[model samples]
Target: MPAKRTALIALLAGALYLVVGVTATDSLLPAGARGGDTTTTARTDTGLVRGTRTATHTVYQGIPYAGPPKGAHRWAAPRPVRPWAGVRDATRPGPLCPQVASAYADVASLEEDCLVLNVTTGASAAARGHAPVLVWIHGDGAVGGGAYFDARRLADRGLVVVTVNYRLGVFGGFSYPGLEGSGTFALQDQQAALRWVRRNAAAFGGDPGNVTVAGSSFGAAAISGHLTSPGARGLFHRAVLASGEGMMDMPAGAMGEGVPAYPHYTWRTGQESRDTGVEMTSSLGCAGPDPRRALRCLRALPVKKVLEVPDIMNAFQAFAYGNEVLPELPEAALGQGRFLRVPLMSGATLDEHRLFVGMAHDAIGSPFTAGQYARALVTAFGRDAETVGARYPVTAFPSPALAWSTVVTDRMWARGTYAQATAFGRRTPTYAYEFADRDAPMYLPLPGAFDFGAYHAGDTPYVFEDPDAQKYFTDAQVRLSDTITDYWAQFARTGTPNRPGLVRWPRFEPGGAVPHTQSLGPDRIGPVDYAGEHRLDFWRRLAGQGTSPAPRPTEGKEQMS
Candidate 1:
């Protein structure tokens, strides 16, 4: 118990560093409410009462959906929070979940006790009737992200908006033999939040039955997981997966000692993976005199030291398949038609991997030369390296980096999105799109030396109104935001995303153009079949024969520092 408390303290301190750096209102309430800034108090099924105000239209801040996950509860399923006796002050933002990333921390105000959600609604909805609900789950590569996203603009468009903060980093995902009692605590947190909405959204002027779960990047991937998880079924009627897919697993299979993992053909038991996780922690410096004590010690360590450990950052290391919450891999389950048949909207950006590669290049001090770029592809492709390089030759591309980013992005995100639509569209309603807005502002602070292009995560601000990034958008971005908000609202109200004044987005049929897709940019909202043009034919060929091409690392292959 002491060990667990130590972990909690360490996590709290780390979260404090991130949250305290940016926000002035440290906790949920400010020292004093601004005079004349409209505020309304509402009660929930739980004991707690919260306050809402007109931040543009109507915004509800710091509403608790679950109890604080601290002490023994730290690694357990999220419990329902106790309601308050009177109107609780909620004019300030809540603490974000414990995480190491400073970017999300500064905005979310991270804390070990953080499990609150914010809501925004249109004034017209309160005057009229309950509005359709749009619950947004954030994406920060599954490590750090929360609902610091401002959704007032969308609420102003006649919809009820919700943004939630979930557990992140080790607090949310880490699983080991010593921690078997707490498997997939982060996912459990999400489930509890969704259930809370089902029971309590009506009080916030939202339709409990008409709910849409949407997200970008890791948030989108989480939506995919939620749509497939049994515990999450019926919580949300519709989903929007922006720049994320469930099929992009590292090595695409579960691994054990002496077992080489392969895509779609390997599976392992939870007990076995728990054993593997123990072994992993030991190698990653969790080797105290008492092995169990080591877990406690690691938890107590500084956040920077934890993130500095390279193994923790690896994608494959983050998500393991043994837990009851995620008993099976999303891709394998989807392949066997084991997912809930919910209507979905999924797609990618024009240059999804460009941002990642650009970060690598700037860190390494040089752009990837044509040959080195091909070599990197070969390195990733392994035995089938040569064939892969030939398929996406650097010479054929305008730049080696561009060619490499194109191939990686297609395989990791775009192709997988297409595959998800192709397979799921067979039995469910699906809408696919590619966010091609070149002028869309990169939401985070990008290095001036880096050229991330219209990369991954750029579409987030479009969904949530960002004050800083909005200034860069052309008039077209404004129109696209309205169109997207309307489409999303309509999807929540109905199973389909069809709305007036926009291009008619059709439902996915086998081998047919989905109408929901738009080539969003400076004034273009036309039918864009980029999936077809990219020769999904080539991608299919690679996947049908699971082998990576050989590496011919070119002169200036990029590398992360």
Candidate 2:
């Protein structure tokens, strides 16, 4: 019976292929019609792409996989792009989502219409036939990130690399009573892009089945979200989550819990986050008194004004643990062995949170003294902070700030990621590594005194093989790009990242010898596991409990006499 079913499906596929009748690449024009330009390429789905000869490979830019989510469509599940009457320009990058004003803001111009992706592949390599695909999801605290991630180096390594831009901030993630049944829209967009790949990758000379989704920091967190999102099933075969995941269980009220906690914000009760999203929208100046009418007004507002209020938009970054989309807290789900089981490679940088804590230092008051920092550790981890601290003491670290940063990093990323990899690896194959390169550039500004050694998001340039990244590393740093790309490509092709001529990557089994994880930076090779110094016993003890201390009586700003 199974054989018959397979034969039937194959017959149907063949018939469908015949009916399609050698149509132009999915979104491109006919071959000869494209001026018969050899440098201009033709494929099945992505259409005719004109590639520019580069030092390493030809590059394709600004391909749209989904329609822009703007105006009335804001916050809706991403929609497929309308078929164009003519071949769309397959040159230059599209705009990126609105980002915080910064040096990188102009990597691609900011705009509402930014659902685009870029691909770079070696001309000679792709000419040989199918190549592996690598889709990158950038992390920007879940607020701002773009698709300018360079892939020329990775492409030179013989992979077809794609980077995507999705909606961000309130426009991309807003939830409200009016927008019911759609809290994970951004994640939905990612899955949509993956589906597009499965259908169109062949046109670009890529193997859709061999695709790997990779990201750093919040991008890593999104990778974790995808691991659990039902919508993401089968979109990609393997994942690389660098320095972030959705597993950290912070209080819902803190940091919007990565999504809105409407109840804590409004007196209204019993409304789902999306339901309350309507109320929050009006509070942010979307017009109309009636909540439903207000959402329409919101839909009509200019994207500029909407983005002007970022504090309001970032509210829905978190997904409800009970929502059908998310199902459960990431850690809880992973521990119970209920997550989407797939081959995964994930890890954190040496000092993942130095950037976060540094940004909020003034607000946190003067740096905590060694003793005070220890006490705060207990507050965060209960008795485990002591044991963890003993293992990673201020005495051992270069400074108190270093010790504090390590604790936070372990709790938020390293240990959580390790525990996640170990737990999920039990049922499925898992490979784990630690990015121990000390001289990795901190993507965000870290005060000079902090010495953000191998801080969060440092691996992106190396993975994307951004050429300008040379400013950050020496000739040795550039080679790390080749090494890391090779490891990633091997993993995407098979379940394991092992390849000849590179460091042997080990499966993440409990109590097994540590895998020599790829270290990318000033010195880009070697393996190290700092988990022992982190004292997992302490963190595990406080794992399920709430971390907030007793509510303290507080004075309002401008205290009344």
Candidate 3:
């Protein structure tokens, strides 16, 4: 790959890391709630587990929801945990799934026995019983785990919060020609965790039937898979997708040089995934004529050897469709309204691509020039390059980087998010939002003079309590955080975010007088012209005029970053 393309790939990978990867200042464990020493115990289906009780909430960590997926269980559907004979400690968190550390994130792990989950419920909610359940899935297809998020804040709002860890990278997503659970082991692990929730939520003071599945970035994309997966039906009553790629399509050169546009940015056909696996078999020293024997040899290899494969973990990041876990591509399923009829809330940040564009320039150690921006347009939009350039002139923005960021953010992220929100709104109650705190804190350790205005994953700290993040929040930002958490908890409780006192969020009516998309910011907290702000009309016209060529399949390596 060329230097530009390599830098772009690193930029994309760094974006993923910023979303869910652990920062140096991040705490691995949540702060203890007020008033300690009161122990609480919950009886899971397997056995009794003790937890720490505070005046505000009760937190249970490192609870096994499924049997360890090691040895013969590797690459197979998750199995039930063997019932324990005595009490199991639920204080510290379990190890994270296998993944290599990256330049942007500090997380690295090689543990395969990592199928664990954490539960937190408000003390008042536990006493009341039947509190609505919020099941959280952490972001990044290859990095991070459940314990990264602190659920104590959300739990305090009369909700039972459950954060889960599943397989990651090659350990969870690798597939072979004869693999029984080709391309879907991680997804299957998530389903198994949901099954565990269904059986044991009552013990944790949650209503099994009133469950809301929520995630951001890759985790949100996985929820999109579950929306259409037969195995996930009735497992969740509501869904929240923040910065999900359910309807995203990558433009040529948007990710890297020579990388063609993909209709489904986060999905792959089972055959394609299997072919990639076959290509890797030789690299793994397990080449053979028989598929079954090759798979056996591949499985017998140590986890370190699998991790050692170049780009192996990122190769399997895109979930394989046309398999049992996902019978069809999630983007296609979502477009045709073939998903379950559930209440939905979906949105993205105002400057989603700024993080990627800024990081790309930062990695290359040069400013994004106006000439480079023009070339990028031609590379991405093809015949519509001049038209796009004319619409978004360099003089219209503060810098070339912001201009390019706005272009991709509108054409790719905003367009996809708008389409998904309208699709869900047409079928079920939907709430759309735009995180518009332009001055949101720069939590990542990125050293640059770029203006990262409410960039990708910037809204994360508002939902999950991070002590490092909280220290940087201004008074207004702190209020915004409380309001956002309330909205989430209220939505999980009642199917809708509307309640007394806070700004009334209306349903997203595509044909209404104005499709209401709550603009979440410290200064402004009401509906904003989402489509107009993102210049979606120009993108819509460009689409109508046939700008780019038809989508083509790119190598899995190109899809990851």
lDDT of each: 0.62, 0.58, 0.82
Could you tell me every candidate's TM-score relative to the true structure? 0.82, 0.78, 0.93
Q: Which lDDT tens digits does candidate 3 get at residues 367-474?
A: 888988999999998889999999999899999989989998999999999888876776678899999999888766666678989888889889987766778899
Any runs in candidate 1 off by more than 4 Å, and if so which?
1-35, 101-110, 141-145, 178-183, 250-276, 279-317, 362-364, 443-445, 448-451, 513-517, 545-561
User: Which of candidates 1 and 3 is the stronger one according to lDDT?
Assistant: 3
For model 3, which pairs clash? none
Worst 10 residues of 1 by lDDT: 552-561
Cα shift from native, residue 448, model 3 (Å): 2.1
lDDT of 2 by residue, 380-480 (tens): 55656677677677898766666777777766666666666666555566777666666665443223455666666656666654433446676776677
lDDT of 2 at 10: 25
On lDDT, the stronger of 2 and 3 is 3
Best by TM-score: 3
lDDT of 1 by residue, 313-380 (tens): 22221344545666677777765556776777877788777765654554236666776764565456
